[model samples]
Target: MSEVKKIATRDSYGNALVELAEKYDDLVVLDADLAAATKTGVLKKAYPDLHIDCGIAECNMMVVAAGMSTCGFVPFASTFAMFAAGRAFEQVRNSIGYPHMNVKIGATHAGISVGEDGASHQCNEDIALMRTIPGMVILNPADDVEAKAAVHAAYKHDGPVYLRFGRLAVPVINDHADYKFEIGKAVTLREGTDVTLIATGLPVSNTLEAAEMLAAEGISAEVINMHTIKPIDKDAILASAKKTKKIITIEEHSVLGGLGGAVSEVVAETNAASVHRIGIEDVFGESGPAVELLKKYGLDAEGIYKKVKSFI
Candidate 1:
């Protein structure tokens, strides 16, 4: 069998910036001394003048990006999730989100998948934090294709955007020609009636595998890749809830105020179905290999399959 191709979404973020820069001259990338880690170094290498290294100050980087946005330049502030969303929460909320600036926050190494970085670096609550802002658009792409598309969409958007990327190299699932990516739309990967598996970010591929496992056991599972957490695809969620009646939300972030929470809010409003959230329970992550951490935390394919089987 051929080996599956894998690429980190952070790499995609950097490559996307380089690609977009060729077309949009006003595109600027700022990094908090993490250009290499966040993959923004690719942009610096290609277009030296367009990239800025803002030292280790994440808060100041956000403020600078906001200021640049006011000058008609689309600025993407790149940094680790912990610093961008956690350390610089005040600046992100007040300077960028409050004013609704067209600054794209490229937050890489999000969630427990940040691996050996341990609890302090793993930012599992970034989605929750970004969602609280009034006009902040959150995009957690599942694979390389989705991530690249999301970066382009973020540049076109005229408001604040939080683009969450991971350090782990995930499988390239959406590599087909007809694959489409929109800001506030959900992509249905598989259709079934037994249950619906709504997933975001790195857990999306695992959720698809779980659906296959459920099918082997004579259970039909619908799979939906929810790339956009904020301004979620409510109509799609409602339709799936109405059809399956049982929904399971999977994500790499925390269960509270993340993708699971967002889906639950919509379902609860209409009382469409029951939602079982699968993600990092309210706790800190431990240092380990990224793959092992995912397996131990029940975010892998086998883990997701076992959880869905028990839920059924």
Candidate 2:
């Protein structure tokens, strides 16, 4: 077997912004004293005129980005997920979401993968909070390839967008010769008739590995990457549920109102199927190694395989 390549989605986001700045002169990047950690410093280095560090105030950063958007400038705000979604949420809703400002929020270090940051830094409720605000588009890209595409897609969009990214490096899964990304459309990586695995963010690669493990045990599993959490691919999900008869949704977020909750709402209305949610079970994450935390919370490939195996 060949060695797997890994890259952080935050790094990809930073690189994509620089690439986009070359094409769009109206593009501007902003951060709240976390340019180094969020990797937005790459944009600052490449184009200092297009980047700004707003001290340590996340709320003020949102206001500045919103103010720039009204002047025909596309602003991409970068910061930790906790600060972006938890601390400056009202500004995002009032200043941006209310008027539908074209401010793209690149929220990095999301979920329990923020290692030593503990529960206070980890943001597991961002999806749930963003979902409540009307006209807010939420995106959680799976890998570096998808993250790059998502940045471009969000740039073209005309309203508020929240792009969720992680701190840990993950394996590249979309290196196929004919890979393409479409906003609001789910990508089916594998085809099967027994059950369907619907996942977003880092869990996508793990779901694919679980599908491979299930195949060896005489079980055929289908995998779907639901990257756009807000405008979820309902057609793909319902079609898969009708064929597979069973479905499992995975994410690195709380099961209350994350990907699993969004999926269950669709499954319950359109096609009823037994759905199992694999993620943090309404609890806070503690400080530990990223991989170890995944295992303890049953978010790894082995844990996913076991859950699907028992469910089936």
- Quantify all predictions' global Cα lDDT against the true fold: 0.96, 0.94
Give me the overall lDDT of model 2.
0.94
| Residue-by-residue lDDT tens digits, candidate 2, 1-312 | 988999999999999999999999899999999999999999999999999999899999999999999999999998999999999999999999998999999999999999888999989999998988889889999999999999999999989999999999999988777988887899999999999999999999999998999999999999999999988889999999999999999999999999999999999897568899998898988999999999888889999999999999
**CA lDDT for candidate 1:** 0.96
Give each prediction's root-mean-square deviation over alpha carbons. 0.5, 0.8
Error of 1 at 233 (Å): 0.4
TM-score of each: 0.99, 0.99
Give me the runs in candidate 2 sitting further than 4 Å from their true place.
Answer: none
Error of 2 at 181 (Å): 1.2
